[model samples]
Target: MSKKLIDSGNNAAAMAVQLAEAEVIAAYPITPQTPLTEKLSEVIAAGKMDAEYVAVESEHSALAVCIGAASAGSRAFTATSSNGLLYMSEQLHWAAGSRLPLVMCVVNRGIGAPWSVWNDHQDAMSQRDAGWIQIFAKDHQEIVDMTLKAFRLAELVHIPVMVNYDGYYLSHTYMPFELPEAKAVQEFLPPYDYAHTLDPEKPESLNTVTLPYARLDINGVKRPGYMDIRHNLHQEMRLAMEVWEEIDADYAQRFGRGGAPILDPYCCDDADFVVVAMGSIANQFHVVVDRLREEEGLKVGVLALQIYRPFPTAKIAEALQNAKGVMVYEKGLSYGNQGALYADLKSALYPYPNRPQLHNFIVGLGGRDIPTEDLFQTLKTACLNGDRNSPEQADTPQWIGLQL
Candidate 1:
């Protein structure tokens, strides 16, 4: 039987990690993410969990340790935020390129220069091209469910997975969520069995230097070159979209929780305007959508993205093809360019003949408060006066909650 309890998101993640039976956990403390690792340590100390907790010196060494553990066919895990994630940049590429099945929780935070520890997506967004699968959670319930699904997804595709949630917003806030039985979770997720384990008896080089062209090995068997290997990784990531859908369907059947694997749509059918976002901000829009429909009589809805890395281009286009307008609210941007999701949405709908007019709004950087009134007003204006023919105006991103 499942138990419902009120707890912080960090504790929810820690509980999920224990339930998943992760063998090795190597982590360093960083704001908002520190409590999660600390909770795991306490659980292990109290004899509630049987696992190896390796305390590392820096974020770089944290990921390096996970890499080493995962290579030896162990289910490895880790967590970090902001600069800590940036410090593990080199290891991030190494883990993905080597095809190690590792799962990590990234409590999203803003990058430092001005030095503020707050909620934002800039840290995870900056690492979008690192070849790791990324999933964002909107609440504490998802923080637990997604973390469990992440481990299975990573092992299935042999790629690292990053489960992202906003710092202090979902991380520090307490909410009630169901924690599933350990027996059910164990049945849902089997033991870790990697195909290629680093065995001393059968010595072989892993992730060695590759030539520009294919070469014949000692047994006269053909081997792929550097470019070919990278292309294969890209193909596997694309296939992972369907793989995740299957895993989510099976999980829902067993635990009665997860059906929508790719995107979660709220009152979107027969709506004229749609709001697109990720993480906790998407949940906030549910309130805005209700207000717009009840008070303003606008047919507005929301589409929350669950998977970010694989892009889900075809599914995204199918969902928004008939809408009149789409407003994308994001917490991170591409510096001089517009919001990353906005750019990707435009690309997704480019092929369709009757595409929706798209607009981008950047909000809640460095833990700035995004009032529901601001969201309602901005979306209200877009529905009333959004330009359908002006492509240039739609391309520019407008900043919300900015003080000058």
Candidate 2:
């Protein structure tokens, strides 16, 4: 049985990490993410979780520590946000390329320039191609569920997994969540049995320098080069998409709770227009979807992207098959182009016949509050305009909730 508790998203995530029985947790403090690591420290000190909690000087060292632990055959974990994540950028690629089954919680926050410690996806989105499998949580329940599942998923694919949740929106906000039993979680996620690990007796070179061209090992056998190694990472990600679905299904069978782990659809079966969003904004869109459908009888729905890394192209195209228009709401934007997600979604649907009219809105940067009514109104206007066959009337990549 699970116990219900009202706690912040950080607590829920930290609890999940403990339940997953991570052996080593090395993290550096950052806004909205600090609480999570702090809680982990408390758990370790209190003897509730038996793990080595390392206090690192920086986020880079934090992930470096996790990589070292994982390489030594341990279930390693870490968490960070915004600039902290960027500071660990080099190690991020290292952990993924080295094929370490390390699980991390990235509390998504806006990036700096004119600095702000607020919420947005610029942090996580910026690291999209860093070779790690990225999964976003819609609410607190998912914060716990996905974190536990991340450990399982990462170990299965021998790839790193970053579990992302909105910073203040989800990380700092408190909600009632069910805490799963530790015994059950342990049963669900078995011991981390890595195929390869740094062993003294059974010695083998790991992460040795490989040139771009193919090379031969000491035994004169063909060995994969750098490019080949990178290609293998891509292949693992594609295979991970299938693995993620299976894991979610198995988890649902055990816990009686699970949804589409990638691209969750709400009232999208026969809808004419569908809103595409990620993270907490996806949860907000659910309210707007309900209001439009009930009050105005608008055939509008929402597609919340849960897994962004593998880029569920086929699932997205299938979900939007009957829709006449697709609108994407992004908390981050790509300079000189559209939003990252907007561009990706456009590409995903591009190959389909009679693709729906698409639009993108950049919203809620630096902790700016978005009015619910205004959001609904803007979407309704866009849908109405698209209905009039005026999809190309204005230049796209529009900015919403901006004060002139």
Candidate 3:
């Protein structure tokens, strides 16, 4: 049985972690991610959750604790935001490269030299190449459901998974969502059964220095080189997309929540124009799509990307093939070039002969408000300028909600 409850996104994630029965939680508070770890600590203290809560000294140490726990065959979790996530950068790579199946919640926020404790996707997007599976949640329910799914996906692929959602937008906002029963979550996710672990009885070195070429072990068994190990990680990451799709289907069958795994399309089947985004911003586009459809008689839809990494190139390309135009709105960009998602979408559609015209919009950095009117106008302009504008004009990324 599932119970409907109204709660903040952070609490939603905490509830999922409780249901997932994480054995070890290593956390250091960083807003808006602080409340999540706090809630977890509270549950453990109240005897509602059976887990070891380690309050670490810093964000780096937080992930370090999780790494140690996960390495020892324990289901471990951690949460952080903005600089905290950046501080754990090295451990992020170590967790993935070591093939530790751990899960983390990254409440997305802007990175700072200017120093603002606000919301953006920069924190997670900056770590796009960190070899971890990153999944974004658009609402409270997704926060709950995806957190549960993250543990399962991580264990299956033997890669760490980051469940990301907008910092204050989703993290602090309260919304109603169904909290799945502990029994149901237990049935969905099995106990962690890692094949390799740091057992003193069976001593072995892990992630030690590797030579450029394959080497023979003391027992004369052939072992992979640095490049070979990296290549295998890449292959497994790619394969994880299919694995996620299958897991999503099974989850939907049992829980009736997650059918669309990679790309969640809202009325895109017959849309002439599609707006693409991730996290809470994508949820906002639903209203924009409806207004354009009903008020302006335009066939526009919204496509929210659930999985940012593993790219899902083929599926994305196929989904947007029929549309005449696609407008990608992002909260983060790849500084020198363009919005990361925009660049990726162009690459995905490059092989198609009749690819749609693409446009990129950067919005809502440092907790800036992204009003619905702004999205509505920007999209309307893109629709009006479709295919007629010069290549340079269309290709250049535009900044929305910019005052200067």
Candidate 4:
């Protein structure tokens, strides 16, 4: 039987990692993310989890260690946040390019320079092109479930997977969840069987530098060059979409809960207006949608995106096709432009004949709390102001609750 427990999102994530039976864990201390790795370390010290925990000095080294472990055919785990994620940028690309089936948790936080240890999507959004499959969780339960499924999906495609949850939002929020048994999790997620790995008996070179042009080796075998390597990576990522769906379906069968691998639509059908967002913020919109529908009799709905890296263009467009307007709420801005979520969503709806009145409201930056009243009021204003005829009105992102 599944156990009911009250715990923070970070604790849930660590417990999920434990249940997944990770062979190795290497992480650096960074706020928001620090609690996650710290919990894992405590479990390791207590001899509860059978894993090699590496105390790394830096985020780059932490991921580098995970890369090495994954290459050696070990299922590895790690966690990081904010600038720590940026510091591991070089290794992030390396892990994805090498096709290491590693799973890492990103506690979403605002990037530094202004130096704020707060919540935002800027950190993960900046690394969207890094070739890793990124999935954002809306709540504590999804965070645990997604982290477990991440390992399965990553191993299936031999591509690294990032299970992202909002910093201080889901990461710090305490909630009740029915925890899955370790035995059941093991059954759902079989031992990771890497197709190709470092073996001592049969030595093989991996990730060797290649010239720009394709080349024929000494054995007269045609080898793909640099361009081919990158092209294959892109193709593999495209394949991950299908694999992700399969994994989510299987997980639902075992756990009695289905995770929204691509997009989570809330009361979208028969609704004229839809609010689109990601992470924990999207979860809040669900409640708002319910209240608006109940109290004001508005046809407002929510389409929360779970997968960000793949962009889920078709799924998102299909979900919003009937809506008269779309309000994109984001915690991160593109700096001098609009929010990244708004930009991608706009491009997705461009080819459609009857596109909605799209509006982007940038909000909740640097850990700003968005109360229910603020959300309802802001969205009410959006619904009133959004005009499909006045396209220029929705062209740029509008800052919400900005003191300026």
Candidate 5:
């Protein structure tokens, strides 16, 4: 039934997983991500869900349990935050290497030394190379919708997928969202087909013993070789770009309203200047773009990145084909650099003859609010000069909502 209800992003994620009908769930919950798995546990206790709830001691075992569940042909999921992600980091790659279509939620949060419970992208970005098909959610609706889609995509491609959303911003924030009809989710994603299930009657070995660096020849002569498992995983990650988009196109046609993009565009066709961003910051920057356009009559656009991992370079370059300049807004810094997204965008558009000037603007670090006027001012300043490398620069992330 199409219906409206308010939900915190974490709760919505748990609800999505239940509706998706995963067979097993395992996790060592951390803050922000904790309430998500906690709700799942409650659902399990109340007989609402018939999945196995494996309460492991550490994040390592949580993911280990997921791999084990998936190996036995059970659709599985888990959720974690910050250090928990890094703690399960090794298992993340293992899950992918074993070709388990495990879907996990990473409530985006700041990583700590002094310790923090706030929101940031450091955790997810730190685990970026772990071979998970990463998708970022801007709002609670995407959180719910994308979590369900993550499972289907992971199963189709035989790779692990992580749906990342900001901790306090999305996880705790309430917003109106409609739960998709069961028929819609069912049609969108059928049941899991296990070609390698570990059934007692038809027993098969799981991510079993492999000699560290050994290969057997046809003549039974053993040769040495490292685990090239990562190579295969890399290829599958690349394939996600095609499979996910094709599936999303179908999904939008059937169930989505306007539908979100791997890179959602806002006025980019003929705009000379564009502001590119990802996650929560993108939503704020979007409002800023509208004001700049309406109030100042400037030709500007906003390109919000929904898919962060496969980086979506080709699409970005093509979309910004007419863009003369770009201001990149990022919540997390690249450390020793202005912005990570800035560096990546610059690299992606490197070969273009008429590419953008690409000015890097870092803002909203550690739960800071990014205002429209700050973006308006930054865009105005970037417009005044074409030199992105000028020594007397206009802004230092332009410090939105800050004291001079």
Candidate 6:
């Protein structure tokens, strides 16, 4: 039987990495993610986990070390936050471009200039085009589950996976979860078996710039001008979508775990109005949905985000089949537009027959607490007005729970 214990999200992530059977862990300490590294080290020191914890001097070297290990055909794990992730930015491209399967946890935080440590998606969004597959967790359980499941998906598809959760929100939040048996996990996740790995006898080169031909090559065919590495990365990422779905299916079958399962749908099946959000800020929307139904009988649903980089807008459209209105309760604003995920969502609904009024409700910036009641009132007001120009109108992002 699995044991239930109260632990922080970072601890849960460390446990997931342990269950994933990572052969090597290369990491640098960063706030909101330091607890995870500390736990990994404790387990390593106690001989509880049979993995190597690489003490890198910086985030770049941390990921560089993970790349070396993964390229050597070993399962690897790592964690970073904010500037730490930015430091390892170049290697992030290299890991994915080389088709090395590695799993890393990103404790989502704001990028530095003023150097404030708070939860935000800006850090990850800046690297949105990075060849890595980014997956977000709704809560503590999903945080742990996704972290372990990420390795399975990454290794199977030869892609790097970013198991992302809120900085202090999920990273520091405490919750009870059943620990999966190590042996059971071993049975589910096979050892690393992939191509282009560094070997003694079967030595091979990966991600090398070969003179000029490599610059202008289209699938090995020399084309015109400019090195289109980004284009090639895009193509590979498109292919990865299919690969990711397959992995998720197999993982579900082997592990027998489901939440909203892959994606959480509150009342999208029959409702006309919908609210979408990700991470812990998303849960507040659920209570609001329930109250809307029980008190006013308003037909509003909540769609919690599980994966971000993939941007499940098609699924959202399908889920919102008869929906007449939509409100995107975005926590982290994308500077100018205010609403970060709104544009991608709009693009997804562009071809839909009944394109409902979508409101980009920005809330909980700078680690501000979002109360359920406030979100309920905000949704009610936004939906009533059918705020068509919400992306442009409204006070930039819909601020909630603020005194000023």
True-vs-predicted CA distance for residue 210, candidate 3, Å: 1.0
| Candidate 1 lDDT score relative to the true structure | 0.93
What residue pairs clash in candidate 4, if any at all? none
List candidate 2 stretches off by more than 4 Å. Answer: 387-395
Instruction: Show the lowest summed lDDT stretch of 10 residues, model 4.
Output: 384-393
How far in Å is the alpha carbon of 289 misplaced in model 4?
Answer: 1.4
Indicate the worst ten consecutive residues by lDDT in candidate 1.
387-396
**Which residue pairs overlap in candidate 5's backbone?**
none
Q: TM-score for candidate 6, please give it.
A: 0.91
Q: Give the Å error, residue 354, model 5.
A: 2.3
Residues 1-404, candidate 4: write the lDDT tens digits: 88889999999999999999999999999999999999999999999999999999999999999999999889999999999999999999999999999999999999988998999889999999999999999888998899998999899888899999999888988998878998999898898777678998867788887899999998999999899989998888887888899888998988888867798888988888999999988888877888888887889988888998777777788788898889999988788888999999989988877588888988888887788777887777677667733667677787777776
Q: How big is the positional error of residue 205 in model 1, measured in Å on the Cα after superposition?
A: 1.3
lDDT (CA) per prediction: 0.93, 0.91, 0.93, 0.89, 0.82, 0.79
Query: What TM-score, over all chains together, does every model reach?
Result: 0.99, 0.97, 0.99, 0.97, 0.91, 0.91
Q: Candidate 5 residues 1-404, lDDT tens each?
A: 76678988888898899889998899897998988999999999999988899999999999999998889889999999988998999999888778889999999887777587788888888887778888998888888888988898899989889999998889998988878887778888899987888899997666666666778867999754445665667777887888888878877887765355588878777788988887767777667778777887888888888887878878888878788788887767667655667777878898876676777776656566666777778777786564655543522344456655
The residue-by-residue lDDT of candidate 3 on 162-243, one tens digit each, is 9999998999999999999899899999999988888999887888999889999999999999999999999999999999
lDDT of 5 at 102: 94
Query: Where in model 3 is the C-alpha error above 4 Å?
Result: none
Can you list the residue pairs that collide in candidate 6?
362-398
Give a tens-digit lDDT track for model 1, residues 1-404: 99999999999999999999999999999998999999999999898999999999999999999999998889999999999999998999999999999999999999998776999999999999999999999999999999999999999999999999989999999999999999999999999998787889877788899999999999999999999999999999999999999999999998899987889999899789999999999999999999999999999999999999989899989999779999999999998889998888889999988688889999999988999999999999999999853778877899998998
Alpha-carbon runs more than 4 Å astray in model 5: 200-204, 208-228, 386-388, 391-404
The per-prediction CA RMSD against the true structure, in angstroms, equals 1.0, 1.3, 0.9, 1.4, 2.9, 3.0
lDDT of 4 at 365: 88
lDDT agreement of model 2 with the native:
0.91
